[model samples]
Target: MRPRSCFVRSSLLLCSTLVFSGTVARAEAPAGPQAPPAPQAEPAVEPPSAPQVEPAPSAPAIAEPAQPAPVPAAPPATPPLGPTRPKIDVYVTAYGELQFAYFNYGLDQNRAGGAQRDSRIEFDTNRFVIEVKGGLPDYGLEAEVEVEFEHGGTGSAMELEYEEFGEFDQELDKGGEILVEEMFLSKKLGANAALAVGRFYVAVGTLSEFSRPTDYLGTNRDEAETSIIPNTWDEMGVRLRYKFPWGLRLTGQLVNGLDSTGFSSQLWSAGGHQRRFEVQRATDMALVVRADVTHFDGFTFGVSAYHGDTTRNRPKADLVKSCEEANPREVAPCGYVSAPLTLLDAHLSVRKGPWSAKALVMYGHLKNAELVSQRNARLSNLLGVIRTPVSDNALAVWGELGYDIASVVGLSDSHHLFPFVRYDYADTQFKPREELYDNPRFRRSVYTVGLSYNLMNVAFAKLDFGHRRLGSSAFRPENTLRFATGFNY
Candidate 1:
C-alpha cells in the first residue's frame, strides 16, 4: 500500500473508534436524573490535499434553562376571640346673638297704670351657646351637650309680686341664666328607632325643635309660644324616637311636670318651669307624644300633645280639698285634688327654593283653675306670683313667611337676603270660667316685618319693626324696632 493511502485509512479508523466509545459510555451512565443537553463540538475538516471533505455544520447554540417561579409564604393565624374597638368621633359648634331694641310701651302691664307710658331702649347679649356632639359608629351610640348663656349670664332682677297687691322683690340670685338646654345619651335600638336619656328639649312646639336664631324669620322667637310656655323647654327624662322609611317620625317622652306654684294669669304656664331651685321636684310626671310627616320635599308638619298633673308638683302639698272631718296628725285629710294640665299643638315648616314659612297653633287647658287661682292669691309675698285670677283655657297662633330677594336681584347663592312678615296672636285668657274674670291685657296680637341677611349660613344680621295691639282698643298700641346680629357654626 502507498504511504498516503495508509495514513488516510488509519485516521478514518481512529475517528470511528472514538465515536463508538463515547456512545457506549453515555448509555451505561446512571439513569436517576438528567441534565440539560450540552452543545456538541463540530468535527474537524481534513486538509484539502489529503481528502476533499465538506466542513461539518456548526452546532446550534444551547440556551440556559429558565428559573423556577418562587413559592408564596403562608399567612399568620388569627385569634378566635377578640374585642373590636369602635371608632369614635367628636364635634363642637357654637352660636351667639346680640340685640338692640327700642320699645314705645311700658314693659310691665300691671305698673303701666292702665296706660302705655314708659318708652325704653335696650342693648342686650341675647344668647351665647355651645354644643358638643359625639358618636361611636360601631356601637351605635351618640351623645350631645348644649349650654346657653343669656343676657350676659349675670345680674340682679327686680320682680313685682301681685300676691301682696303690687309689691317689689329683689331677686339677687336670678337675673340672667346659665342654662343647660340639652344633655343626652342616645343608643340605637334598630335601624329606625333610638332611645335617649337625660335632660332634653320637650318636643311640643317650634321653638323647642328649632332654637337657633337663624332658624326663624323674625328678630325674636314667637311671642305666643314664649308667653304661654317655657320656650325651649327641657327636663330630665327618657325619650324614644322612631323613623319610618316613608318620612314619618314619632316621639314619646316622660318628664317632670310643671310646678303649680309658679302658674299665673299674665303668662299662664310660662313661669311653671322649675328653675327656682338647684334641684327640681319630680313628684308629678308628664307624658308627651309627637308625630311628624315629611313626605314632601322641603316641607314638614307635626302635631304634639302634653298631659300632666300640676297640683302635686307645687312647692307645698297645700292644694288638697277640704275634708269633712280633719285629723291633726294627717297632712292631707282628703286626698289632694286633681289639677291636670293638658296642651295640644300643630306645627308646619317649609323651606323650598327661595321661600320659607312656618305656622303653629296651640291650645292649653288647666283643670280647677279657679281653685288654683285662689291658692296662688294667698301665697307668701316672697313667692313672686301674680295674684290675678287664672283662666281655664289659653290659645296661641303664629305664622311667618319670607322670600329671598337675593335670588330675584341676581345675587350669588351663597348670599341670602330675605324679606319677611310675621303675625302672632296669644290669648292667655282665651275663655274664662264663671268665677274668673277675662282680662283684656292677657290677649295680644302682634304684626312684624323684617329683613334678614345671611352670609353662607354662618353669619347673619336682621332688622325688624313690630306693632302690638291689645284685645281692647282702649289701650294704646305698642311698637318696637330691633336689630340683631349673630353667627352659627
Candidate 2:
C-alpha cells in the first residue's frame, strides 16, 4: 500500500512539469484573435515544439590578449665633411740635406790659422722653415720664418747661429737679429693692378727680388759688386704694380734708406756723418722703378733703376782729422763728402718651345768721399778701404741656357723638368788697389749644371753641380753638389 502511494505521487509531479513547460512555449509563440483554426494536413501532427535555443555556456573568462608594440624606423646616415678649401695656412716645412764640398786654394795665404779649407762632408739641420700665407692667389699675403743652422763652415756649409731666422731675413736686424720677415698686407685693386706695404725685400734688382730658394744659382752675393745696389736691402715701404694689355708691367716703390747705425764704420756714425748723407730717419726714403715687357711670344725683358741718398752731408771735421791722424797714408781729409748711391740693372729672357735663354747685367756706383782709416796710415789692406777710385765701382753679369728635355717625354707642367747650364761672373772694385785699381779686384766665376723640376705652381726642386774658380784659380775637384726644394703657397 505504501509503495503504490509513492509511485502515484511521482507520476503526478512529472505530468504537472510537462504541462507547465508546454504552456510557457505556447505563450512565447505569435498570438491571434481567438478563433477555431482548421488543420489542413492529411494527418495533422503538431510539430514538435521548436527545440529550445539557449545561450552558449559561458566561456571561461579570459583577459584580452596583449597586442605586440610596433617597431621604430631607422634614421638616415650622414657623410663626413671634407677639408676646407682656399684656406690660410701657417705651417712648418722641415727639410735638410747632406752636402759634399771641395775648396781649391791656388796659393795658401800666410798668417791664416790651420782651419780646414779643403774637402769635407757636412750634415746640417735647422734648414727648416715656417711660413704663413693668407688670401687668394689673385691677391694675398705671404710670410716665412726660416731656421738658421747653428754649426757650419764656409767651405761646406753656412752656420746660422740663430737657428731661428731663415736663409733669408724676411725680417731681421743688421746684427743677425730677426725682427720681421713680412709684416705687410697686399690687395688686388683691379684686373691687373695690386698694392702692397710693410717690411719687404727691396724690388731694386732682378736677383734680389726672387723669393724662391730653388731659383737661385749661388749661395751668397758678391759683397763688393752688390754693395752699391745691396742685395737683400729690405725696408718698410709701399709698392704699386700694374700689368698692361700688351704684355708689359711696371712697378714702383718708396722705401727708407739704410740707417746710420747700419753703416760699417763706427767713426762715421759717431761723427754724425752717416745720417747727414742720407735722409737719416726711418722715413728717410728712396725710389725704385722697374719696367718689364713680355712680347714676341716667349721673350721677356726688364730694366730697373734705383737712386737714393743713403747718408747726410754732415762730415765731422774732428773725425776727419782723427782719421787723417790715424791713417795719414790711407785716409785723406776733405771738407765735403758725398752721400748718395745709384744703381741700374737690366735682364732679358727668351723661351721658345723647349729652350730658354736669359741674360742679366748690373752696375752700381758710390758717390763722393773716398775710403780712409783711423791710423793716419793708408788702409790699403784687402779688407780695408784702399780698393776704390773714381772708376772703382761694381759690375755683375750672368747668363743661363736651359732646355726642357722632359717635355719630350710628355711630362706635364707640374712634372716638367729642365736641364740648365749657367755662368756667373762678378767683380768688386771696392777693395782698393792703388795702381790702376789692379790688386784690389775681388773677382769670381762659377759654372753650373743643374736640373730643375716644377713641383707645383710657385714650388720647385733643384739639383745642381757647381764648379767655382776664384780670379783665374784652378777648379776645385769634386766641386759642390747641392739639392734644394722650395714652395710658396
Candidate 3:
C-alpha cells in the first residue's frame, strides 16, 4: 500500500511538470492542442472503504477459530460426566402351584376328603405369589413387595376370624384373600451389610429360602415346620445383617411376638399368629438372632433362637375373664400369667451340582404351660368336661434329599427330574402339661417320596406319595397320593 501511495504522488508531480511544459509551449505560441485526458479507471477504486472490509478484523476472525474449538470441547467434557446416571431398576417375579390330592383315611371325625369323610380326591390351588422389587441408586435404598392369591377366588372382601372365647370359626368369605405377605424397606450399609424394616419373612429355619413352592423338592413344605411353626413366618420387625469375608453371616431382629391365648394343644404356638384380627399387640416383643456359616462349598449351616413374652400379646378379654360357670376350680383365667416362649432351631442346606438336600429341627418351650392350658381349656369350652391339652414344649424336625436324573439320561441342561425322599416328625404336644396324660395322638411323623420335574425354566411338576403316622403302632396310619404343578420365576 505504501508503494502505491508513493507512485501516486510521483505521478502527480510528473503530471504537474508536464502541464507546465504544455502551458509554456502553448504560451510560446505553438499550435494550441491540449492533450486528451488519459482514460481513468481509479474512479471506481476505493482501497480504504467500509468498516466491514478492514483486513485487521479478519486477523481476529482467524484467532477466534483457536478459542471456539476448545469452547465446544468444554461443553462435551462436562456432558460426559454430568448427565450420566445408572438406571434405577424395578423387577417383577411370580410363582404359583396347583395340586391334586387324595387322602386314604380321615385325619379326624370333623375333617373332610377321606374314606370316612366327604371326599377323598380333590383339586386345589395351593399358593400364588407376585413379587416386586425396586432400587434407588442415588439414595442407597431398596424395597420389596409381595402380593399373593390363595385358593383362587376373587371378591371385594376378605375372610377373617371372629375373635371370641369358645369360638372356632372363621367369618366366612366366599372369596380368596389377596394378601400382602411381605413389604419392606432396606438400606445398604456397605458392600456386605444391610438394614431392613417393615413386615418381612423371619429368618428362623429353611422357610426363608423354601417359602416359595418351587424352592423345595417335595409336594409341599415339609410337614414338620408347617405343623409346629408358622409357615413362611413373616412379622413386623427391624433387622440388621452383616456378612463376613469368610462366608459367614450374622443377623438380629426385634419384632412383635405370638399371643399365648391362641397357643393351644393342637396348633401350639402356630396359632399364635395374629392374623385373625387387626392390629397385633406389640406389648410382647421378641428378639431373634441367627448365625450361618457357608465356608464350605454347597453347604450352609445355621442356628437361630428367639425369646419373647407371649402372655402380654393376648387379647384383653383373656386377662380379666373370671368365669365362675366354666372354671369353679380357679378364680380367673390365669390372670395375666407370665408365659414367655423360647424357640431354638438349627438348619442345614446343601446343593452341589445335581444334588439338593436340607434339614431343620426346631424346639420351642413355654413357661407356665399349666396356667396357659388351664385358661385355654375353659375359654375354648366352658361347659364341656373334657378339654384339649396344651403342651409345655414342642418339637419339629424334617430332612429331604434329592438327585437330578437328567444328567444320567443324557438330557439337555434345561431338563431336570429329581427323585427325592423326605422324613418329617412334629409334635406340638411333645411335653404335655403337668397333671394331664399325654395322648399318643399328639406326636406325628410323615414319610414322603416324590419326583419333581422342571420345564423351560418356567414350569414345574411333582408326583409324590406320603404316609403319615400318629404316635406308635397302636394308632392307625394315614396315606396320601398327591400331584402338584407350578411355575416360578
RMSD of each: 9.4, 17.0, 10.8
**How do the residues 271-292 of candidate 2 rate in per-residue lDDT, one tens digit apiece?**
2112122222443467889998
Q: lDDT for every model?
A: 0.83, 0.49, 0.76
TM-score of 3: 0.76
Q: Which wins on TM-score, candidate 2 or candidate 3?
A: 3
- Top candidate on TM-score is 1
- lDDT string for model 1 (1-489, tens) is 544454454445445544543433444222222311211111232333323222222212222234455778789778657776669999999999999999887766654334466779999999999999999978899999999999886644445455856554656764588888899999999999999999999999998778898899788999989988998999988999999999999999999999877888878988888876556778889999999998899999999999999887776677998867788688677878888999999999999999999999999999998888888888776766666677799999999999999978888999999999999999999888977778788899999999999888899999999998888877788899999999999
Best of the candidates, lDDT: 1
The sequence of per-residue lDDT tens digits that candidate 3 reaches over residues 34-124 is 3222113233223334223445546667668677443343343434646667668799999999999988776563233212533489788
TM-score of each: 0.80, 0.55, 0.76
Model 3 spans > 4 angstroms off = 1-87, 107-119, 154-171, 320-335, 380-387
Q: What's the CA error at residue 463 for candidate 2, in Å?
A: 3.4
